[model samples]
Target: MSVPKLLIFILLIFGSSTAFAQHEEEKFDAAGTILHHILDTHDWHITDIPTGTDAEGHATYTPIALHLPWFFYSSRDGFTFASGTESLLEKGYVPYHEGLYPLKAGVSVAEHMDDHGHLEIHMEEEAFKEAYVDEAVTVIDLSLTKTSLQMILIGLLLLFVFRGVAKAYQRREGQAPKGFQGAMEVVIIFIRDEVARPYLGDKAMVFLPYLLTLFFFIWFANLFGLMPFNSNIAGNISVTSALAVLTFIIIQVNGTKDYWRHIFNTPGVPWWLKFGIPIMPIVEVIGIFTKPFALAVRLFANITAGHFMVLGLVSLIFIMSNAGENVAGGLGIMPISVLFSLVIFALEMIVAIVQPFIFTLLTAVFVGMAMESHDDHH
Candidate 1:
């Protein structure tokens, strides 16, 4: 998943001078680069495949990714929807410091000191974060960012793929499974047997659909990022938080009266603890939220950190290479770096499926717990 991103981040780290040469040399900013990779961005950084060098010695980069639409809205700032970077700038939205800033008169432009530097252009999306700006506060950025784009793409993919799977069932009724349907049936049955039936019991069918959706949605998003040039969507906190929120909503909406009683008026506790100080009730209420919060943070942190590790290892190779000054030495270290990255990436592949199952399993567990009555418990 971090393949292309790791390479780009490596380029950014060991002096963008070697990587950019003529386009725009960037001073290595490790913090900015890591944060940029972990957090959701306006642009999806497809890999930069090198084209022929220009007459002026600038290396040409053919970026394979898409630039999603940029939307900015405010009562004073007015609304603007620009489909691309050029269009966004044309509308007077300055790309600066991880957000769209208002481009007003006398905006500070990037300067090059002949005594120390080469031509530096802040116009490109890559350099947007460090692009200097004096003014321009942010408005609502309802644009299709990396996360939103991935979500949309994955949603459509599920719709089409599962639609075909559904049709296969109709045409092949009572017949043996074939191809895609067969593969998915295996997963579907596993979820039904291991996840839904185990936790949900009698109401397994009622929640089976949601549990399947949760498992497939997450697993799909994770695997989607593994596709060449795709951005890491599941690693984003907002996306994980949304998944957690859905679990929370389902838990509360289906909670039995006993669930509320357990929280607000926890049983088996002393009167002093329950009514005198309101300690157990407060703790129980907080516990309800903590479950979902943990779900969100755990998924976000794990995926992000895994990507970070891969990128960091790749970056280390370049740093050791001294930006390719020592080609032999760099090549020597390449095998080790690649080996370690592959090992972790393989682990991440397993984690992609495991994490989703964990989330769905926990969600089912929570829901089942909430549905229990005094009679069932006793």
Candidate 2:
């Protein structure tokens, strides 16, 4: 056949196949849109494309997404491998009722019939909890999620950068810093002098490696999240909590005799207070976990909240403009959305720097507290 006819034939085959591939995606309500942007999922959602009607004559929109692998291993199943979420669904899961189990296939989760005659399960409810609580939890998700991907990227970026700097240092032995090395030297010196020294004292050098890594890693992760279509790494509580746990572990492991004594014994407190009250040591012990908890929550909240605000502002454009389908509305809303988003984006960048500093500084302070002598406290 001719080129034009062949092209037409190919289009007809594929175009008809995708007709019921999707439905007109539900409109993004403010809260849902904001949450969706902040929350982690199994795939990278790029955009949606319109398709023909479904059997029920509903307008369809096909999602264009990059899927991540799903890894689940159970004793019964040995190890199940699915290249993507769709594959997982085809393997066993059907519509995801609870705990990766198919609806009506096993555990019953509460469902309700909607006005449109559809069964809806509120996954946020007690039914989900009930379904999961007794279920044999055999699957371990080793899959790389969006957050996982971002973290790996951040780690590789840090590795590539500092490795180059390390080599630069070796090459330049006694010479002056140059290029990226010089720029990084300034930041490194700033961290060592400003953040680590004041708090960690002479032990600043001892803790500098971790403190420097924490600061730069966090800062990098925050900035990475700010990029368009990137996962919100800093905003993920799991990621932040893991970072805080590292600091906690390091602080505890490296804690001086003075630190343990300060926790258990009364240095300056009265005997009665130590024995009878027991509040001081209890408070001190609790403070250890609480400080790290605060670090995690603060970073997570600040980054997540900023992202939510930015997403909200951007979503406002779509809400008003409807992707230029409404020209008058688009013109009216575009400038407002852009202006506010830019302002928040700027603030978020500052926050990106400030939060990492705060985490590192507080970590230094906690370490110093643990290392400080009784004489030092006074």
Candidate 3:
């Protein structure tokens, strides 16, 4: 068979398996299911096995989840640590909505899923606090979540891969590159010559490490998100926000006097815009913030959207089948849906690589802009 034919066969098998696997749920909430997969959770969820039916006749599946250690601080209890949710619950904490809350008396942790498939937090913020503990009590979540653990693993993977590449360079000094090292050298040189040097100029070496780390971390995280049973690290806004903040800090710290002066009093611009209304200065200050904001949102949105597309397409099979109640309908749409999903999966792979490149290139441009001198511009 041709490669395209083989690819279609693989997608059909994968999609069919996924669709049947989801049949365990009596009722499928497509949005809720998608959100559950994309969002961070306290534990790593492997799969769900049908146990029995609930009182309402809805199917119940016991989730097979892998728990990470829980470490959080509560004003009422001071410091607390537990191996996982069960242990934490033993310590009077309940894992609710990806957070650990104190399980107070006369309180219930419940979730309401609407007909439209949106999950409504059963408790209001104040009510939630009242249920969990006293209003004055504060909880600080220091626990390792699914997303956090994935990020840490990605960091370790980068270390391992690059360490090998580093050794190859040292051992084969002055020799032509081969295999893995050659492939990595292509990327590293691409970033150094095409991204870092172009923007950072003579100071490329100074910022190369940070740029490389930023690029590889994001690219690895994105790729991992596409893998089976892996957390969407790049899709999480908090992760992207932290990365943006790092870039923001680097830009500000490296900002030359000329950079600030340009923001405050943009050269060659109307003095009226600078002094009379302070419009130029205001816009410049806002630009400083918007740069990082754009960086964070772009990566997070792009990555998240790709996952949503892939999940949504697969979900259509189950939804149309009505969780196996209408298997005929599902079979009818299966081919089209799976075909679209396969197309999207291919595109997402490209996006997984391109998004990081864009992010790193922009970072270099921003930093280089900060290091610009008045004399250089003139």
Candidate 4:
């Protein structure tokens, strides 16, 4: 059979098996069970307790709940805090559910003055009930979340790398670039030629650093999301929204006087038509806002969808296991999962690089449009 025919046969077999596995797994809710195991078993370090056996053959206290690493935590009450790690787990406590972190019920020991002396008070879990805590806040808002720290470090490293390259170029004058400088020179040159110059003209150099930074940061973040136990920083809508807002700001601020005037006052139109022409400008302004919104949503949706698809595919095994280990299920599903994962991995690599290109390309297009001069045509 032809390659296409073979592929189609494989897909049909894979799809049917996947559906059966999902049905089997659904009977026992294997996906939920597995998810809970992964999420809950991970420590977020809120509080710790001791519960191990002692040398005297009696129950002894051993440190638990030592290090809880959480993304974000907030309370409906006035009190709020973001720490490097959840501190409550050092006492040997575990998360209430499998994958859900109770951000609000964070407990800490407090000192209170009493008649005898200083007393340590353990805040009851009920205290948080009245407090109304929300751990679902944006990971970016979390104090020293691993993802946030990684982004910062990535930014600083890129800065130093680029700066060093720039210094080398300056010192070498007209000589050929070498070492790290040479490697970066090639990339910068590609960005200028392929991405920036095609859209932004001679003035593109001014925006090169911003474009480079935006591309590398986002690309790296997306790649990082694929790592085991890593947070999906780029997959989060807020991060993409912030990037879109920046693009919006740049497009508006860099807009020339003519750009605005053309919107408000058309150069060639009838007296009656002038009034109607202004509507075009209003629409144009709205378009500017919509462009960035589209950018943000597109990136976030694509990244997130890819992740969900991969997870769903991987979950097939546990689902099929419920049906008495039918060798057909494992024989069928594992190869499909492996195959699709490889394909998706390749796509992700392309996406990591392509997303940045599209973002920077659009930003450049907007910037170029803002800087256009009608009179220059004459």
Least well predicted 10-residue stretch by lDDT in candidate 4: 91-100
What are the C-alpha RMSDs, in order, of all predicted structures? 6.1, 12.1, 7.6, 9.6
Off by over 4 Å in 2: 1-27, 49-64, 73-81, 86-140, 321-327, 375-378
- Misplaced by over 4 Å in model 4 are 1-79, 82-146, 163-175, 178-180, 266-282, 323-328, 376-378
Tens digit of per-residue lDDT, candidate 4, span 291-320: 999889778766665565566566665455
- Shift of residue 142 alpha carbon in model 2, Å: 3.9
**Clashes by residue pair, model 1:** none
Off by over 4 Å in 3: 1-27, 49-63, 90-92, 103-133, 376-378
1-378 per-residue lDDT for model 1 (tens digits)? 246545554555555444445334332334345566666777787677999887778777676666677887844457878876567555656555457666554544334312223223445554543454324455677777887888888989998998999999999999999999999999999999988888778999999999998899889988876555566877888888999999999899989988999998777778899989999999999999999999998787667767776766666566567666767767888898899889878988998898888888899899888887876552
Of 2 and 4, the candidate ahead on lDDT is 2
Best by lDDT: 3
- What is the RMSD, in Å, between candidate 2 and the native fold over all Cα? 12.1
Residue-level lDDT of model 3, residues 35-90, one tens digit each, is: 77899887898898999988889887877878788888988788888886557656
**What range of 10 consecutive residues in model 1 has the weakest lDDT sum?**
110-119
Prediction 2 TM-score vs. true: 0.78
lDDT of 1 at 350: 90
Report the C-alpha displacement of residue 239, candidate 3, in angstroms: 0.4
